[model samples]
Target chain A: MAQLFYAADLFGVAVFAITGALMAGRKSMDLFGVLVIAIITALGGGTLRDVILGNHPVSWIRDDTYILVASIAAVGTVVWVRLTQPIHEKGLLIADAFGLAVFTVYGTEVALQHELQLSTAVIMGVITGVAGGVMRDIICNEIPLIFKKEIYATACIAGALVFIALRALATPPWLDTGVAMLTVLATRLAAIRWHFSLPRFHLLDRD
Target chain B: MAQLFYAADLFGVAVFAITGALMAGRKSMDLFGVLVIAIITALGGGTLRDVILGNHPVSWIRDDTYILVASIAAVGTVVWVRLTQPIHEKGLLIADAFGLAVFTVYGTEVALQHELQLSTAVIMGVITGVAGGVMRDIICNEIPLIFKKEIYATACIAGALVFIALRALATPPWLDTGVAMLTVLATRLAAIRWHFSLPRFHLLDRD
Candidate 1:
């Protein structure tokens, strides 16, 4: 079970790192910039989570494995982009959804382990799922997708709430995590497919 | 002494909040958006510092006073802008410099309290001084000022290093903080006055 969890975490990291590198490429950033963005996108969310929870040393700082994985994924992305053209938008979206789902579940589990309130735990999960992408967008000088009308953060929130409810009902841990991850992945992919989005908040209409 | 420190902190918070509200005003954000940005700009740096240092509940989360001060400042900015038709650029720059100087000293003090290495402490001080503005710029979809040719972060680093040196030389605590704050303020102001800037890093020159 532990190995499976680790595998999922690594998979999420790789996907996010690739997405980060692709963004840097699109912006025509240098090699160093690409690697920095990739590392931030792969680890920024969890680092924020651990920091907020008062977890010291942070995960990547404590164990070098996460950084190693992200760096390899970033290099792979650069090579692939050079060999074949840019990755299609659809493929990137799917990969991002997978990362969001896995990171949400992992973040929730960590918060719960620290005995945070369920509401706070759910918020933490959403933060973990969305913050890295937000940071990536911010660093690239773009508005964050989550703050837009996109249904991104909503999916994470839904998954986290469901996960907490299942745990409260005494469901098996693995089953709970599985259901939550599936819920996030399905919601995100469906949103993309249907072009579903939240209504924008406009205080005043501009010309 | 504690009261003096608290007063300086609140002054910094108020100045940063006003700057945030002004940025939001420039972006034509609504009242709610203005308030949100204001609070974020006032508290984001300190929160990031605390989180990175494994200090839980964060400063603003632990004490409601900071939020109260920021809210008041944001509203004041709105009213002031409406009445005065925008603050002068020079005035805003001075206020921002004041906030940066005070926050740098405060952040260094916090890092020293944690017994961090001198270099790490200096870095933390710079982060705390500039992160809020960076976040504000990012949220407004502008490139961060610190990352540009601006001498902002450098001033913070210089001040932090000086503060650490003074402490190492057994200078009085208050004197150390005072000198450091003045150093930052003077460096920043001089840079603005002289239009001094670091060279920009351009991986590829655009046509």
Candidate 2:
């Protein structure tokens, strides 16, 4: 089970790193800038979550493997994009969905282990699932997708709710995890396919 | 001494919050958007520092006062601007310098309390002083001022180094704190007055 979790985490890291590198490429950033953005997108969310939970040394700082994987993924992304023009939009979206699903479940599990309240744990899951992308977009001088009427954070919230509900029913842990991941993946992918989005709030206009 | 620290912290929060609200105003964001940006700008840096240092419950989360002050400041900014056209740039800069000075000293004190290495403590101080503004700029879809050949972060670093030196000399804690604050405030103000800036990195251009 631990090995499975580790593998999934690495996969998520690589996917997120690639996305970050692609963003940097679009911005015409240098190699160092690309690498920095990739690392931040791969680890920023988890680092924030751990720090908020008072888990010291942070995961990547404690274990070098995460950084190593992200670096390789970033370099590979730069090379691939340089050789092949642009990445397919659909493919990138699918990969991002996978990362979001895996990270949401992992973040929820970690928060639960720390005995946080259910509401807080769910929020933590959403934060972990979206913060990296948010940070990447912000650094690229763009408004964060999650904050810009996207259904992204909503998908994570739905997944976290499913996880909490399954745990309450005493479902097997593996089954609960699987269900949560599927929920997030499906919701996110469906949203992308259908061009679904949350309604924008306009307080000043209303007044 | 505790009262003085509390006053300084509150002043910093108000100054930062106003800056965030002003940025939001420039972007033509609504009231809610302005408030959200203001809160993030006021508390984001300290939150990041605390989380990185494995300090749980985060200071703002532990105490409701920070949130209260930030919200009030945000609302006040919106009202002030609505009633009076534009915020005075000079006034804003001075307030920001006050915030930077106070936060740099306060962050250093907190890191030192945790017995961090001198270099680490100094870095923490700089992070605390600048991260909020960095976040504000990012969320507003602008390049961070600190990263754009500005003398901003350098001022914080200078103050932190001064703080560390004073501590090594076994100076009175109050004196040390005062000197550090003065150093940051003076440097920042002087830089602004003289239009001083750091050299920009142009690696790609040079190549």
**Model 2 over residues A1-207: C-alpha lDDT tens digits?**
778878878888999998898888878999999999999999988987887777788889898999999999999998887788877767767877888998888898888887777766776787688889888987787677655434676788889999999988989888999999999999888878887665432223210
Instruction: For each candidate, report what fraction of the true interface contacts it reproduces.
Output: 0.19, 0.19
| Runs off by more than 4 Å, candidate 1 | A30-33, A204-207, B1-43, B52-54, B60-133, B143-207
Residue A19, candidate 1: how far off, in angstroms? 0.5
Worst 10 residues of 1 chain A by lDDT: A198-207
Model number with the top lDDT: 1
Q: Give a tens-digit lDDT track for model 2, residues B63-112.
A: 66787898899888877766666666566667778889999988998899
For model 2 chain A, where is the 10-residue window of minimal lDDT? A198-207
Q: Report lDDT (Cα) of residue A55, candidate 2.
A: 79
For residues B1-207, write the lDDT of model 1, one tens digit per residue: 778888889999999998888777766665645666787789889988987786778766456678789989998888876765556666667788999999999898889989999888998898889999888888878777776555888899999999999989989878998999999999999988887787766698789
Worst 10 residues of 2 chain B by lDDT: B27-36
